[model samples]
Target chain A: MKIKKNIPLIDQHDKNGFWGKFGGNFIPETLKKPVEDLTILFEKLRKDKKFIQERDYYFKNWLGSPTRFIKLENLTDHLDGAQIWTKVVSDLNGGAHKSLNATVHCLLAKRAGKKYIVGDTGAGYAGKMLSMAAKKFGLKCKIFMGAKDIKRQKPNCDAMRANNAEIVPVYTGSQTLVDAVSECMRYWVSNCDTTAMCVGSTVGPNIFVKICGWSTSQISKELLIQIKDEFGEIPKKLKLINCVGGGSSSFGFWNEFMHYNKKQVEFIGVEAGGPKNSKKHAAPLTYGSKIGVLHGAMQYVNQDAEGQIEETESISAGLDYPGVSPLHCFLKDTKRARYTAATDEEALNAYQLVTKFESLNPSLEPSHAFAEAIKIAPKLSKDTVLCINSCGDALKDRDILKKRLGK
Target chain B: MTVSPISLAFKKCKKEKRPALLTYTVAGDNTKKKSLEILNSISKYVDICELGFPHNTPIGDGGQIQTASYRAIKNGIKMKDIFQIVNKFKNRKNSKPLILMGYYNMICRYGENKFLNKCKQVGVNGLIVVDLPWPDNKKFAKKCKKKSVTFVQLLSPTTSKKRIKKIINDSHDMIYYISMLSTTGGKLKISPKKILENYNSIKKINKSKNIVIGFGITIKTINSLKKADGLVVGSAICNEISKSINNRQNPVTNVTNIVSLLKKRIS
Candidate 1:
């Protein structure tokens, strides 16, 4: 029940092992040796500062890092309740915190001699990002998406198609993110010899978290610099906030901040509160789950007693997963981080408020952050400035906004 | 002392100087009575019996076991019936080990403590769940230990030496090392030399626990594993049952053929 004590990051060369409950190599026996080899190689490469610098170079030059922190002056006034600030993450690539991890995965694949890749995606952003990187690297990419998602998230599907990544629409259970992940897992198990699964987020096994940890590191570094620059001093009691689905954005934002900013800063994660108190939400933090295994690692899952996956609900398709990253579960349990929820109505309101005020349309996922921030911001002193992770561009959700907001 | 099924099986294996033939049939393969017939026929020659509890999807399993699991389920083989078979088997064979093998979902539904209690009540001895690798740390293992039920560790060739050593050290009964790279009914490829070498090496590390080689093991494959303490013949026996049912032949004769052939090698 106690939080697993952290092994010194320096002494640990691989991130492909158990990270609290979140990280481990949950691959088939055939893939174990190769993935282990990849981990060993990646660990050594990651330690070399030059490799990191080169990776950062791509972020700065290609993917556009140091994403803007725009204060939502108008939205704060409109909410008439609490202040809301927008972190612009959508403009990073086509739209997301995905490009940061995608670019690094491609770079690592190139270094590790990985030529082909496969992935499971929920809303198609990560799939698009992976395809984008794969096309650039001249590698074959196959993305598995839920059949329902393929229909609903048409724009993301279009993006993946444009990148020439083969899209396999899975018609399995719930046709959401977790189903796509299961299909991807089966595919990887079958094709372990040639293809590597570019698992997104801090979920899956160690290989996944390590790949994601890079992005989290970048987010932290940027936030540190931005805090110093904007406020003329790093806010002493700032709370770092983001939405946790599979938790790459939150993990990316928190890894550096969690341990280093500990005692100084508190990390808050917002999960999708689908249909409010109904099984329809993806609130892995609150009610939607218990610790169970999915996609190779044991974590929290909204599953039946018989282990059948339950349908997950959320306003954000990306956060509409039945499972949360085990690391997040560990963090939640150990009280290292606090997890809360923002209902669909609240997230939408936050979305509309931010757009009306700041003229920047943020993804519904991040509005969960805005909603949580609204509550937390009021109690903050004038000296206290909280940083909200804006996640992806909400341009794709325009129709949703117009319908919901009567805009 | 209530001996763990694995330890008892190992003692029997050593005394007989033959590999224990462990047959895997879905609890109600064709019918519960028919499945019991196969089990009873094989019991005379086989040393241990592995009853595979069917699930909706057997990810690690191939065609034969999948078919058997499906057939068992088609005939209404609930988790409860698994213990019923074990109880019946106990009336027939007073000493031979009976092991239930499946995934964690089954345990989660049946309830860990409840499952262990049933195993003890039915005089079942051991369990080997595929999805559960960290068996030592799970509540199931602790309950099984408390109930004196042996928790068997399934090992593959790819299992690390550290893991193998830990499993050997942690295991209460015999080690069931899967011989092939694939699941049940997979084609056997390991040469006699390799099997002997692996058996010798594993035996060198842990002499107390019995080492049983399974998965893709045939009569010939089982013969090659003389260095192993026991042979767990699952897919081959299940495949034979499937063939007999499909081709309209005597399953008893096929079961007898495999059981007699394997018993000869170990003996």
Candidate 2:
């Protein structure tokens, strides 16, 4: 694998929040000023020394930064092909990579003199993480979640309640993540003066996508160094795999490696394929979905011929969204990142295989990625390094796993 | 350029020395025939009628309008049905100008050119896309202008003085001023006086533009906001339709009576 020179980095977006015509601020008039103010404040804070120090302190001391990057020796030996490594983001506080963005947003809220923080969640990890961060920062917290997700991710909902965050049930269309986001945005419209909306993923309007991506990019920032330190240099024929819901964890995992030559380091995003025979899956990119706007950004959306958003189904509550991130859409069009889908049965099989082989329990969201890695790992050369971001723990998924796996 | 029907309606209201009454209802709320009958009944009292395209996910709407949309969508309302409603309402005698209100996804799916052509053919005088705001709506607004359809722009209390100027300059014939920072059907968070003050500040940017205040203008609050060029009552009308359906009464007659009362208050 030869390294190429002068390749433009995919990390930067234009001032209007567009990543190759994918993102823009399409919010209602009631939120224009508030979104503008947030963007201005975030831009200033990202450059301020004191603000950076405060955010880093929380990332390192409170939420546990630089989570481990280790090889899955047993799984690699069993595959007998590429060596598999994982960035154990599930080991972080709040038990997922969601805390990174939540901590940054809570800090942003405090810096802006806001007394309350609001957020939306799908799998409940984001809501729980925001609740934990808000408690640490002494700000009032409210989380809007789809009524369906409330039932699916009950343990995390209980954890959010234990943290004293008020949970608002969204019973609108599909009763899922997309509705939760819409409800949260409506709530933010009225409460913008006193509250800051902490968007859970790299979706939403331009500012939110930028903010979430900026905060979570720390994953690749650390992984870049960890690779050099572990193997003496960046490995040739490296492949990175991560699951895409609203594409937060995967974007963070692949951010630093995006500038590398596409031939040397490949990026793969796995989407939820739902049931084996069901047509209702959450793989918008894999299904060749049309470009449409939802939740304030233009992206690949699962919509009907009449442009109405279609309902999506997935065993993992987080990945069951009708739209993907704008950045992922850009990557897909540019042929920078390859995307595929893993069925519910495959993810469940991967979950079992990981637990049995490595004594590790990964959340159902990343099990999609592991399923994809398992398929292609055996076909790759033994010298290739395949890194997967185990983004969350399966503790919150006990109920679903129990019913599905009967274990 | 020929004056849009929306502009002509505003001029007529100015001559009458009263704020123009604008009523909103879902296109196929309850049923297509009843929804059209309701429109025909209410058109006699209102200057502009806004018919909503029922969306499964209406983010900017509150409980009342969301319920109205759900009822319409559940009854199998389609895009063609909304256009047919507009066409039938326009064919009626002494019909008011109709404005189609919906999210942008519908337009994207229908193809912008084809959607605009359909609106032109159906006699849709104006459009108010809830999600497509300034800069983003520039292209679509121009497309509407080419089709002789007024593309209504929206302003809110949160709009900065600088942005107000830009939006008003690009506005077609009318601008919607959200009286408060909330979704449709919310309780008025700010005083009518404060909202007027904000409205006046925006009005000063371009006095010629027809600015209507919406988002929480009920019968109780309509009289107080009657000094503006126009007043839009959406959720209140939607609430009336819901109540009429629950009571097993004629929704068209009940909705007409409410709009008549609202018009009398402003007049």
Candidate 3:
């Protein structure tokens, strides 16, 4: 790792709201006016004092801000590599880092003076948090979930519905997260004036990239403070790793760190590798995919020769997306971060290991990170450090796994 | 940019003092032969013919068009099949301007240059990629221009004034103005007076002053859209095809008759 005394200045988004040619507003004329309006409004409201105070209130008071950053003694001892720490992201409401932005977006919609909110969820955390936050903020919530996801992540879907959200069952386009999100985007465009689209990831076009990035940056900011207090100072050989779907956690975890002058950390993003039985995987970055435009943002997309996005397969429904967030693409391309994948077997075994060893159940999404941690930690020196932002609870996969095992 | 066959049709319509009739149908909807025969019949009556290549997900589409796409996909309509349909339509009598309109991903999958070359080879005069909004890789449109195929853009009521000013002077002959926020078969709740007010404002900015309106347009609705340069019939015609197919009749005859009726109403 090249240790630079001067911190690498990471531009979250350029003047056109691009993360180095990764993000932009590439939508129809019907959506152009509203997206541009959102672009202008986000730039103004994100810096406003009242808007900042309002979202911060929800984060600290309701969503449980300042998640615990604890050095894992058990995992650290097992690997005997570096001092490993886990940023416990489930210490908040709705059980993940999803609440970080979901809460903020509810306040944003309230400030913009809209009534109805619509969004699609891959893992159900975003849907749950948005429904919960919108309910608390006195706003209407509607969620779109894929039919397959609705069956697998049924508990999460019921949770959102319990919060008085209208759960729309999407049976189109592979019946997965990608289809649900695409339908939601078209619905938003048709009803942009009356409804606000709550994005579940840091992907999407401009203005949205900025909005999601600013809200989730709190993860890195809190990690900075906790590390300073625990280690006395930041270490030179620290590796930051997290799993990427639409990359909310990784994007949030790395934002503030890039602003530091002494930038020597290696950031790695773990993508979902398919089950051992199948060659179909969702790791677009690892596969060296084509750079194409989808979801209004240009980034790495898992597509066929005819430019149609391919149907991705993964054990974890949340991680089974064909396109990655533009920020992750930009980061990987610039070598600011690296990316790898863990097979479904590896992640499943890692989840069981964490639950038994630490008596803690982690979601299948972040279980990929756990697998990477064990693999990377053993290769590093014991004096070095490894950190994982542990963000999901695997209760959703437990039932399916048990049924598969005939429990 | 080359003056496309579409532009020539518009010029002829301008002399006749009537709005040019633009008709649409999804290529390979049901079967290649059946859909091409429908296209052949539709071309004789309409000034501009838009042949849509079905996509897996049609975002701007309504229920009728989506069902049409599903039927086409079920009938095994691929990108190559769409061009094959156009090739057959190219030799028809009074075929008028043929525009290959569909989602951007289909063209991208076909390879932008490869797709444009295919369009040129099949005598496609223009293109209207539904999701490839302005500034979304103008590179594809530029490639189309190089092949002497006009890449038409959409300017809706929701389009910003800034964008209108930017695209009005482009060499494309006409712009598609989606009349409502609703999909193709959505109710005619769009106020004609409001559409004209917005249409005239958009026209005021354009040097060509060519604005064709579509979305929820039927024969009854054509008179309301008389102020526009041209009238586009998409879902209404697709509905006729669906109804004819449902009644165990040849959709080609039903669709062509509807096109003639729509052309009569506008003229």
Candidate 4:
């Protein structure tokens, strides 16, 4: 269903935490001041010229900015449709694009005079990256992880422990990323005096989504320049595809382009599709999802008939969440973007295919996008150019892959 | 103004020169019949009853209430079922003022009009939506006024005196003054002297002077909270219910006993 009014989220904040009826500050009264204070400080810092320069310096020198944009010649030829290019986020420090926002938010926390950084994570990559950032920034890091996630991503837990970050396992609700987020909110509410919640996704209250999305938009800025340098001019039909858990990468990757090329570009967001004939997929927006409030934002959620969130299933640990980012919720609502899904088997197959075709081991997170690209690329005309973001490197997922393949 | 049960309860407490016991528990906890029995018996001890609508994700709640919600949901309590439990409580011999307290998502999912219609049909006297406060959602508060369901607003230490009057102007029956800057069941970090200071500041504006303070009001804490019109005892009572459930005893008896004990001490 097309949204009755197609006002973009960034332009439509009536200031009561509304993002086109998708994002809101639906939180407890004790948290009201903290949310508003963060909104005020984040807006000031986002526009500060000195803060921007310092952040740019850290982006280049500390967290590995200007990651490469590469032409996937073999994959493009194999598909034989659109000219395919990829933004290699794997080259960034912490082995994923997650470090960008984590590092930036750590600076925000220090500027706010916060002594500790607290966050929630799904697949463990974000928590590890945030822990490393916290260690470097001279702050204490506390991560809330699901017991289920801790078991699946043991290597990430070890890395977080090595950085001296405390991991608090959540046992409530489904004991997945959704519960981790809820638990982290309770912790943040109790300790909002001395701590800043460096939320993992671009899905939180209004202030959180705004600050995180703007900071992470560096990817699209760099990708824009690289694409311009590759082709003499910006292409008319540039397709930007990225996999989404809570949609940090999709929000970051598509934000700048959507602003710069609103009518000129197509944004494609993919989610983890569980096995066939099962209620396991994590594609709430792609599938039929209702608008409800969870973890401080009103967005699309895979809730039961009685408005209770349901546990989602996926082979990829990162994408196994019931809710998506509110911006994606807005995009899906307003027809500003296309939403799709890829099954676990298909994502795994894409992981292997890309490993062989590009000699780059891709995480199952972005492999969902690659999986969809393979389907859509074969049908697109030759002049169209598609950009896929390799947001996660598959190095940490070796054990899961080995077990799934039974190799 | 029509005499709403919430206003009546506060009026009675003020005339009697004692704080009212406002007890809270989720409807349909364990079972529909048993929860109704507990609520009816609980009405005899407390001056007002806060009925919680059990939700899947109670983000503002601590562990004890979350566990109560889990049991209530497990017992097949829907939004509609909560009303059935409320009607059962209202139909009892000694019916107390009933306020439905819950997160906003469930009501937003139920839609505002449909939920208010259900509240009116079930004779719900007041509402304490833990998430929606006074600043932006006055439209919702207006709708509740049309239906005569008191849209209870919250005042925390974080709220300023200037903002407190505005919130009090929006409030109808009672102002839920959160005693600390934390979720329910957290220890009372603020001294009773400081909490009463904030509570009395609100009485300076609103004529009714009705305020119910909650969050860490134990048997020991109840003595110091008698200056207010009412005190909400939720987590302490829920903790007793959880203990009885774990010990395979009757949760209703345990809850009724603690509420009675707290009411006696406060009086």
TM-score, predicted candidate 3 vs. hidden true structure:
0.93
Give the TM-score ranking, best first. Answer: 2, 4, 3, 1
Candidate 2 segments exceeding 4 Å error: A1-11
Count of backbone collisions within predicted model 3: 6
- The candidate maximizing lDDT is 2
Give the alpha carbon lDDT tens digit for every residue of A252-305 in model 2: 999888888778889999999999999999999998999988888889999988
In model 3, pairs of residues that clash are A7-A261, A81-A382, A306-B109, A307-B109, A363-A392, A363-A394
Q: What TM-score would every model get versus the actual structure?
A: 0.77, 0.97, 0.93, 0.97
Q: Each model's DockQ?
A: 0.18, 0.76, 0.54, 0.67
lDDT of 1 at A301: 77
Model 3: what is its DockQ?
Answer: 0.54
* Predicted candidate 3 versus true structure: per-residue lDDT over A1-407, tens digit per residue: 22233532224555555667677766667887777777677768876898788777778888888888887888788877877788988887788888887887787787778899998898888898889988998899999889988888877888898899998888877788888887888788678888888888887776666677777888998998888898799877778889988888888988878745324677889998888778678899988988776777778988876566778888888888888988788778777788999998888887776766675667889889999988878788887878888887766666666865443
Considering only chain B, report the TM-score of each candidate against the true chain B.
0.93, 0.99, 0.96, 0.96
Query: Model 1: residues >4 Å from true position, as ranges?
Result: A1-35, A190-194, A259-264, A296-298, A305-309, A374-386, A395-407, B1-96, B104-118, B134-148, B160-173, B179-267
Please provide, for model 4 over B144-246, each residue's C-alpha lDDT reduced to its tens digit, 9 standing for 90 to 100: 9999998889888778777787788777777888888777888988799998988888777875658889988898899997998889998888788778878
lDDT of 1: 0.73
RMSD of each: 5.6, 2.0, 2.9, 2.1
Q: i-RMS, every candidate?
A: 4.0, 1.2, 2.2, 1.3
The better candidate by DockQ, 2 or 4, is 2
